[model samples]
Target chain A: MNRHILSVLVENQSGVLSRISGLFSRRGYNIDSLAVGETEDPTVSRMTIVVQGDDYILEQIKKQLNKLIDVIKIISLAPNVSVFRELVLVKVSATEKNRASITEIVSIFRASIIDVSNSTLTVELTGDQEKIQAFLELMRPYGIKELVRTGLSALQRGDTQISQTVTE
Target chain B: MKAADAIVKCLQKENVEIVFGYPGGAVLPLYESLRSSSIKHILVRQEQAAVHSASGYARSLGRVGVAIGTSGPGATNLITGIATAYMDSIPMVVFTGQVSTELMGRDVFQEVDITGATEPFIKHSYLVKDATQIPRIIKEAFHLASTGRPGPVLIDVPKDVQNDRLDYVYPQDVSIRGYKPTVQGHMGQIKRAIRKLRNSKRPLICVGGGILRSKAQEELANFVTKAKIPVVHTLMGIGALPVDHPYYFGMVGSHGFAHANRAVSQSDLLVVIGARVADRATAGPGLFAKNAEIIHIDIDPAEIGKNLGTLIPTVGDAKNILQQLIKGITSLATDQWVQNLREIKDSQKDVLFEDRVGVNPKVILKTLGGILEDTAIVTADVGQNQIWAARNFPVTGKRQLLTSGGLGTMGYSLPAAVGAKIACPDYQVVAVVGDGGFQMSMFELGTMAQNGLPLVILLFNNSRLGMVRELQNDGYGECFGIDLTGNPDFIKLVGAYGFSGIRVHNDDQFADAMKTGLAATKPFLVECIVDPKESTL
Candidate 1:
């Protein structure tokens, strides 16, 4: 099995995102994490997709993605070279007895408490996948109530764009 | 100008002399503007025929073919042909009408998401929400369809967008950021291929549809001659070289010549040009040129290693790449390989035998070949008749044969001939079809009649689906759904559509009917009564 990140540039059109993700699900491939947002140009959107599969699945995904006309470009970003981040918000149960301890744990993990209730604390954190997972695990001992994470968003460290002009 | 009028103007500017379309509820405004346009429109009976004809036109002449249909069923009917062109990489731009923007998702009458339906098939599609986007969308659609491994492009126009007026501003250039197709091959790769070609004692050139699409036939022939290589063809790659050419080996596939397959197996080096090594061409990936060092030349980068992966992948335009390769190559002496392929071809020449009193499709197609010349364009429907045409039709040195090779669309020939004959008026156009596939798009006879296209409809009546039956007979004990219980009397049926019908039950009568059909100024239908169980192979 191989894990690859594909930074997809697509025309900002209705149902385009649904079409891409739907194609993956229908074709029976795994999308580990998918994050999409407006790029520098609003007319186009950038999607950072994390997928896990063997060579056959990778080739199929590449061919299938190219077939989608809404997709403008797909650049396979190397995990070692590019920086990616994920944001997670977790609400953990905290009694007055362990509130000070939980606050200390939050400070150590560099997480900020967004809201403080008498029984629960909502902490927001931003980090790489590993950091987020570790933080979630650390807070689990304090009784986790809820958890939400924005999927990975990444950008290359270089200046080149996959949006090179194609002449007819 | 109205958006519809602007569209007509844009089509005119694109030099689209002819287009095929059918009228329906959603596309009224576009059709209304077309009444006064200079471009000629051939009204097809069904929406499916419109797309088929357009693709036929594109296949015949290497220009982008235009086709149109309205929403719902009209657009849905075009799906098969769209997929056909997509698979074959035939350049076609299809315009489909949509419901008004307000009623797009409201379950409105005659409404369907045409772009969504065609998403998997087309190279690109545009759903114009704004009227001002019409001009740019039209330009982009044409460019996308005809460029870079040509395939179908669709533009779905909402009814409201067509009605709304806008200043017509056509984009002079299409600068798509992500669609750069390499035209010139990497020089280093070309040099390496030439060196490999020069060294190989048993070298073969497997030309395909891409050579025809790229109009690189002359260059390919030149390269083959200079390299002293034998040429093998896939089904879609027919006519890349003259059939009578000394080095031209016959097609390679299931129904293809045994010699060609033998050549692919024996060759030390296989130079594949512009053709996707489809399963039909390879049979299976296992024994397909396994011993040969394969060199793949294709326009699409994705297609290079998609199927039977190659050792040397040269991605670029065939003409440009061959032109570059020709410069460094002098003379490749392969007299023994050439003689070996010649012997294999000579052994397979007398394979197909004749039946005097029955309609042998092979005999029919061969007889048609005897009557027609290089100027004739034969569009074949899917199944057994297509196999006969592919196997027996002696057409070469020109882009004359068109078939739904990749998609295997059942009813393609009749409408395809309509479009081909319309595209090239002087050429003798013929539609070779089986009884099973004939009924699928037989209504296009009316389109032929209305347009006055002097086409010969060669109906091969086997009284069953020959390929399907062959499969059942070989694989299953009993035939269930392959037989046609009540096929129409084609000769009599065609007479009502302004065609002179001639029934041929004997082999001797086929040539005469073809002569008559070939000479006729109006439409003619020559029906061949083929044996029901005859293996097309």
Candidate 2:
């Protein structure tokens, strides 16, 4: 099994997100990461999903998902030809001794400190799955009090946007 | 004039006598108006059950079933039920409440996009923006839901729209652009089909759910007998052809009869009726009717060549198309074909009746057939009971069988039987449900009692979900959540609903119990404690 990045287009409506998620939950399939946002058109929205399954199973899943009324289009992006990233906001407890080291590690991981208090440092990081995993592992030694990660949101390597393919 | 009054008037115009629903803040207006209306409202414990009950009602009643729910969570809860009905092609109208128009995009409390969420599942959907449109939309929703190939429809009315002041003028006609369904078949295609059937040696007839939807039972029977072809039914096609009918060969599916599959594998010409060749029915696309020249007939053009591609597709209702075909058909000598089919039947003789602990499912079905009237509409649930009834119930005369073939939904029988009883009060309505299936829809017993509908429910209490147990035996190696170990006493439950109920523990009591249940002028439940290990299909 491999992680597949599927871009789905659906009508902008309520409970659709819950319904889609409920389907995965009911089917006993674990979702790795999911991100949904409004498209250029207000009526339609795009959702990026990272799920691990066999290619055939994934195809069947996509077909079933496509059968949902709100879902308009679903396209699986090739890993090599796509750029994927996830945003994670982690708040870590920092002492005088670990502050410098944490800042150095954050710079190495291309992360920025979004918020810093006397006792805690909230770092905002954006990277691919592998990079995010590496950063989280490094931050493990330095006490991560809280961490929230957005699922993989991907775009094709080239300038082609999903909107250009179908006008509707 | 008030919107609530308009809603009541709309329901009266549509001829809806009973509706399954739960009260909600957004729908209070309609509910308030319903208090004074002639329509009987069945207040379900949950919104999801309301929709399921409506699905059951539609399948049993042979008309559009109505269900109502509130905004947000209530609407979302109805999604599964609506999808179930849609998948099964059971006609139903689901009414849901929405936040007022002003609160629609403001992220207000209890606001959801019901129309968009339900559009894919329903045959059609409407969002009532103004109260003036309620009457017309309600009329059209029922019309679209019941006509041609049936399916569920949704009408999401905002709180303001439900309470708005508008003159209630029921639409004289429903005229919507891009919504004309074709009713008649092409003469050329009809002639071609007749010519092909006449020329073929190994001919077979495959009827789907469309025959019942179109109420073309007489035409189908006449055509089948005149054509002299063996009939194989999809799960949805059960009861369209009588089980005792000489040419009937049971069902065709993964769980279908061995002889039926062999017939499909061996037949040269296949005449497919209203039902679609679903993946579950065909086993797999690779082994499905590989050699047969399929002549697919359906009212909906999209269903034709959808699953297994059709060779000769005739687009029209089953009755109309069959009537035309009957006129144009030329007689063929298929003595060899008939002999081969009979031989296969003899070779694949099912040993379902040999099992004895309680009454064999096949025997129970046959017994029920003998006891019930010929004009009864039998609604069956999924599981072994469905298979057994499909194999044994010899549907004849005006009687019909209703099932959730496409969805294969459990807990379908009780509510559907209740609905059917309401639709045809004069006709005997029986719901043949397995133990697990009956438990899933047991709440409908109260609804039946409340409405004074004398619906006969036959609960095959095997203590286990027989189909799931079989699946475990075949694949899982263990049956986990398959048993109804602590299930409520169905008879006691019905008694609590103030209806007469009977329990049959032995084979001798089966006929008597059935007679008592049928004789009751009020709703009744007959729980027959059946043998769990028995395989009826």
Candidate 3:
């Protein structure tokens, strides 16, 4: 199995998000992560979706995406050639016993302590999948209370733009 | 300007002459505007017929047909008809009146989320919230439904939205953000396909319904004449060429002819145009044309490599690609291949239909074929009789055969023919239906009677759902739900509705009944007894 991060450009139309997600479920394909936001052009939106499937599954998804009139274009960015990132807010228990250790761990991972309270510390981390996972593992022993991670969004490393050349 | 008036104006801009629809309380404002509009609205007996008639109109006229229905059950009833058009890729624009904007989600009277409900079947759907957006939405709906791989697009206009006033400014040309369809095949792909055809010793052209939809019949004929390839028709593709054309090798697959099936199986190279290689046409990909290098040409890019893989896929409009192919190809001697297939075709003939002890549908179709005009449009229902019509019905010239081929809709014929005759009043229109299938939507006869639309309805009485019985015979060893021995007297049923009709059990009376019916000013119905045991071709 290979991990594919597909950057999809779609028309900013009502119920388009539901339609795309419905397609995944209808085709029996699993979506690991997905993030959608309005692009620079108000009429269009970009979707960053991460999926883990075989080559056949990837091919099927790509073909299905093109079939949706709302979907304009899709670029499957390779991990090695792309810059991938995810924002994660990990709130860990910060009792007197483990306060110092938690701060050291946060500094080591280059994560900022966004919220600090009497009982917990909410660490905001933004990086690739590996960096987010590593930060969460070290904070796990402190009796982590809550966690929320944004779905992956990626861009090509070089200055090869996607917007201007996307339209037919 | 009133939003409802603007909507009508937009339809007029699209050159829609008639609309098959039913007016209800929620849709009063639109009807109020339509009262004075030049666009003729045919009030159908039911919402289902409205859509079916639109489909029949689209099929015969090669134009985007329009259907309208009120919200809730009225809109819900149009689901099957919309789905039928979607499955067949027929171009249609369906407008369903919605509840007032405020009562949309409050579950007020006659409120339904039509856009959400028909998402799968609809090519595109819009829930109109603002009155000002009507012109753009209507224009876009027309553009989407009639372009590329044509299908049904729907717009749900809320009653309150229609009542609201706005300055109507219809766009000069639509500019959809992300919906451009490829209209021309890549030249490289076309060249590659031509090279393959030139090399293959046994080449076959598999024709589908898209040719007729694209108005590519002349180009297909031109291509075939130069290529000298034997063409096989899928059920929906029957009218692509004359049924009696020397190169035409009948329909293919499950109920397909033995020789036609053999022709596909034995061919070394298959050039499939317009036809999606459906399971009914191919049986299964593995067994179907196992040795053939398949070249699939289609207008829909989505359909390419779908269901069955192809060696070379050429995507574009059927007419454009066919025209290109005609210019690129050089005629080769397929004398041996044609001779061999003709021998097999001759040997395999008359095996599917035999003159049985009872009233065989084969003889009925044969006799009917001899009687009907070359320019008569026959709307056929789904049953065992459908297969018989598909095989034996002499589809000649411009007169088309319209059916719920994709949806396999049982009660489709009568209502659709009403739409067809209304659209093309000059042409002779007929509805060929089975007894069990006839009863499903037979009430549409009242609509025909009320409007005084002259139509010839040929009802084949088998006293059962013929296809289901055939399936039961093949798999279960006996029939259950398929049998309907206590069917109502069909002729009397139509007669009570004020139609001049007859019930016949033989050819002589059948001919006389048809002749008399055709001569009448009122809608005519002829019910003929058919053998239930005989298998459909």
Candidate 4:
């Protein structure tokens, strides 16, 4: 199986999210990650979905997604042609002894400590999947108390916009 | 003007002549509005039958069927009918009353989130929060239900919204940015399909209900005759081609004919039109047409490669795609292939159960097929009766067989027949149902009587859910809850509804009973005793 990123534009309606998620579960397709937010146009919303499947399964997913009446357009974002980022907040257990080392590692990764107490430091990081994974690995020695992530949100690298493209 | 009156005005704007519904507390306001309107209303015994009847109306006339019900249980009851229409792509617009907006989430009396409940099956739905949007919403609902790959759309109106004041102005046209359906096939794909058909030595065309849904039967016939391809159909595709057509093979599936299934397996190339190649039609997807190249044409792109692998995929209306194919096609040299299929079809003997106790259901259906007019409409309920009608009933001229093929809802035929009779009063409408399924919606007999519909109800009594029993006997080696031992005397039941009926015990009695039933001016029931051990092959 291969991982694929789908950028979709849908009508910004109350139950649009449920319709998209319901379709995935009903069709037995697995969603690895999903992030949705209002688009530039208030009437439309953009959904970034990450799914893992073979070519046939991916094609079926795309076709099925297109069938939903609220869904306006769907574009597959290839890794090389798209910019992907995820924002993660990690609360690491910190003592006075290891505080300097944690700060050093945060600086090295260009991540910032957004919140801090004597026992723990909360770091906020935004980067590609690989960068975030590496930072999390380096912070493993300090012990992560709590963590939350906004799943991968993506955009095409070129001037072409998903909303502007004419869907076939 | 009141919002409820505006809703009625919107229906009028859509040219909806009739609606099927059962009124309840939540929809009282809308019912009041309908009371003074010119459009006719059918009060079904149950809310489920309302939707089924509407489906029958829609399928028979190629129009968007309209049905209404109240909130909570009323809306819940329409779920099966909605799913049935969705599965078969029947065009329908359904209305459900909602609890007052304030009481929606409080678990008040008669409150249910119907739009949420039906999201998976409905084509589109709206939970109306603004009364001022009623005219626009109703217009959009009709457009969504009848356009593109047609299916059911729903509108849920709270009682307060129904009574709220609003200026009525129905939209003249619909333009939804997210919902444009392809009406014309891609030229390149059409050419590729034509090339594939021309190159193949043995080509077969498999059509489904989409042909009827798109009103493409004539186009399909012209294409078949021009291309010299043998045709087969799914159960829902029964009326797409005349049963006596020389190039037409029988229905194809597990319950389908052996010769038809063989034709599917042996063909070198398959052109599947308007069908999703569902599991019931393919029997087993992996082995279906394993050696054949496929060309799939459907309005919905999702159905193209979902089941069978397609070498050429054409996305458009079936009628439009078939028209394009006809325009580009030259005659194929498939005389030898057609001859081989004809020989195979001719050599196969009709499977019979001579030792069984009662009259064979297949023989009864065949006799009824012969007795009925060429333009008759036969609605068969799910199970053995459905298979019997689909296989044995000869569909010629404008004859149609309406069944709940996808969801296989048992009580569909009786109410659907009611709808068909209402849609085409001059045409003969018959409801072919098994004993197990007959009791499911027999209450609709009152609806028939109230409307003075002259319908012929052909009831096959086997004292069991024959299909389930057959499965148990073949697969599990034991039967459990298939028996309907306490089934009522169907003739007397009809008599109570102010209708006349007859009981047929053998083959010789069926033709005469059918003739008598057809000759009667009132609703007539002909109950045929079927053998308990008779199997659907």
Q: With candidate 4 superimposed using the best TM-score fit, by how many Å does residue A122's alpha carbon deviate from the native?
A: 1.1
Pairs that collide in candidate 3 are: none
The candidate with the higher TM-score, 2 or 3, is 3
Model 2 DockQ (Cα-based): 0.04
CAPRI quality level assigned to candidate 3 from its DockQ score = medium
Q: What would the per-residue lDDT of candidate 1 be over residues B1-537, giving only the tens digit for each residue? A: 999999999999899989899988899999999999899889999989999999989888789999999999999999988999999998999998899999989988988888887766678777889999888888988888888799998889988899999998888998776576778898888888988988898999898899988998889888878878899999999888878887899899887889999999999999999988789899786668888998999988777777766878898999999999888888788998899888878877554555434777787788787788678899999998999999899976463889998989999998899889988998889999988888999898888888788889898887889898888889886687987888877777877776787888888888988889878888898888877768878
Q: Pick the candidate with the highest DockQ.
A: 4
User: Residue by residue across B297-346, what tens digits does model 3's lDDT show?
Assistant: 98886676776578998889999999899999999678799898899988
Candidate 2 lDDT score at position B240: 80
lDDT of 3 at B464: 79
Question: Which candidate tops lDDT?
Answer: 4
Q: Can you list the residue pairs that collide in candidate 1? A: none
Task: Evaluate all candidate structures by whole-model CA lDDT and list the values in order.
Answer: 0.86, 0.81, 0.86, 0.93
lDDT per residue as tens, model 1, A1-168: 898888888988787987898788877989998899889899999999999998867877887787676778888877777888899999999998999998998999998999988899999999989999889888899999999988888877777555662211
Q: lDDT tens string, model 2, B107-145?
A: 788889887777556776778887887888888888788
lDDT of 4: 0.93
iRMS per model in Å: 2.6, 7.2, 1.6, 0.7
- Candidate 2's C-alpha runs over 4 A off are A1-168, B105-109, B352-356
Q: What share of the true interface contacts does candidate 2 keep?
A: 0.00
What is the CAPRI rating of model 1's predicted complex?
acceptable
lDDT of 3: 0.86
